[model samples]
Target: MTSPNAAQVPTIKSALKFFKVTSYITGIFLILIMVLWAIRLIWSADVWIGGPDGLIALAQFSVDPSTGEKVGLPGPQIPNDFTTVSLIIHGWLYVAYLFGDFRLWTLLRWSFLRFLVIALGGVIPFLSFFTERYYSKVAEADLKKVA
Candidate 1:
């Protein structure tokens, strides 16, 4: 005895639930990555200037590239370079988070302004954790009413 629109309700509800879960998980991961980035940035003052790997320099004992004499230039600081991999992974995950936001927002027919506000949760460090809790409560309440 369900109308066509009623049939669609479950699908939409499920999608929203998924987004809420995903948003929480991805948000947590992004927060952790941001923490790692901060640690690396604060600690890498001297060598962390070049890039994620710091600056690449020839060893002090190595020959110069242009000249034939033994010389050295800054090279990637040992494991600091490894942080580049984390940076790339976080970037891609954030993109995926955006898609999850789109799906949930589209299904719920949320206003663009609200969507933008929610999207900010991903970038502003620990904001995601707060936003995720707030949205989970909202979604749960709304679902309860529907049921």
Candidate 2:
């Protein structure tokens, strides 16, 4: 007969699934932000439908509070501002990823240091893809033991 703790197998499976989904999503958004940053920093331009040349550079300028006109040479602005939206979305997704990480890590009873390392995956661009693969394998192995 299975041990009492074997019931945790299903919970572990669910937590693993949640962690995997969140890891993939967070990793994708992080990579997207990295690509966009590269475009803006390296090329000094971002894709924009309204940009005269089909691209626009991020700009910050002083504004005349009274006149409501941009001061100095007006800089280019992103017509759609998808970059900001992507960044904000990534921020929130990272939070969700953390929840998954905590849930999985808690269930598996792994070290806090390992948890911190896994957490870095959310911010380190392609790291999530790697961590997701590695840790998921580790979890699956542990799952076999539990079963």
Candidate 3:
């Protein structure tokens, strides 16, 4: 509160808006990543690029024709980059979320621990949304005090 930059109300408000948007987008992507992780666990984690049924998730095993028995290995298919693409996209989005977080944290001159907690919001499912709401209220109150 005693920081020299504390008087920069407009900058803080803009930072708050940026942080809010990043939190929401990162939260949604986090949920999507969680969903993809679950899907991988339930079926096969591997996705194929160019098989007879291109761009598909392979099962854990294949069936034997002659013996009419289940085989332990999966059928061959070209590995697709689609599975990892979403993960990469999320990673980059989280970085953007971090940038917004850092900007807000710097403007408010908050503690390092608080900054870390806010950073965690992007990784934990639904936590970003909660943190966004909580901080929006806190920032609004703080801005009012400054006014």
Candidate 4:
């Protein structure tokens, strides 16, 4: 008769696949958020205002007709929609990553501390790539031994 453990091989394989995919996705989102954050920080001071001519004009000093001196008023800056969207997307993806982490952690019967470490992979930029690689190898080896 086949051993009971043999029946679990497929399940473990599927879980491994799921965890790997989620790790890559979460890592990608983390990178995207970092890029967006950088862009927002660099260009945050540039402002656009409604010009006297009824057109949008970048906030800059204009020569006064009489005084022959540069003078300009600060205008309302446009919102950074891209940064906002990036934050929202990353937040949701992290949640999904957590779910994936929980699944693989439970399946592997790892300790709670290990689970927390895997979850951190989603938050720390570039860490997910290494974590995923390490965990993938470890899980595969463990599963092979079980099989």
What are the RMSDs of all candidates, in order? 8.2, 5.6, 5.8, 9.0
Q: What lDDT is obtained when candidate 4 is compared to the true structure?
A: 0.70
Predictions in order: lDDT:
0.60, 0.79, 0.75, 0.70
lDDT of 3 by residue, 6-93 (tens): 4599998888998999999999888888876776667745444454555464545445799965454344323343456667778988
Clash count per candidate: 6, 0, 0, 0
lDDT of 2 by residue, 1-147 (tens): 223257788998999999999999999999899988887677554444343334554443356899975454233443355576688899999999999999878888888988999999999989999999999998898888876
Q: Which residue pairs clash in candidate 1?
A: 56-74, 56-75, 57-73, 57-74, 57-75, 58-73
Best-performing candidate as measured by TM-score? 2
Residue 38, candidate 1: C-alpha displacement in angstroms:
2.8
Which digits, one per residue and each the tens of the lDDT, describe model 1 over residues 1-147?
112244556776676666666667677777767765665456432223354333542122344678864333344444433345556666776777777677656755667876787788877777767776776566555556556
Question: Distance from true position, residue 43, model 3, in Å?
Answer: 1.4
Leading candidate by lDDT: 2
lDDT of 4 by residue, 10-117 (tens): 877787787888889889988988875664456432233343534443344455789874355353223323444566778888887888788777777777887898
Of 1 and 2, which scores higher on lDDT? 2
Runs of candidate 4 with Cα error greater than 4 angstroms are 1-4, 45-80
Candidate 1: which stretches are off by over 4 Å? 1-5, 45-80
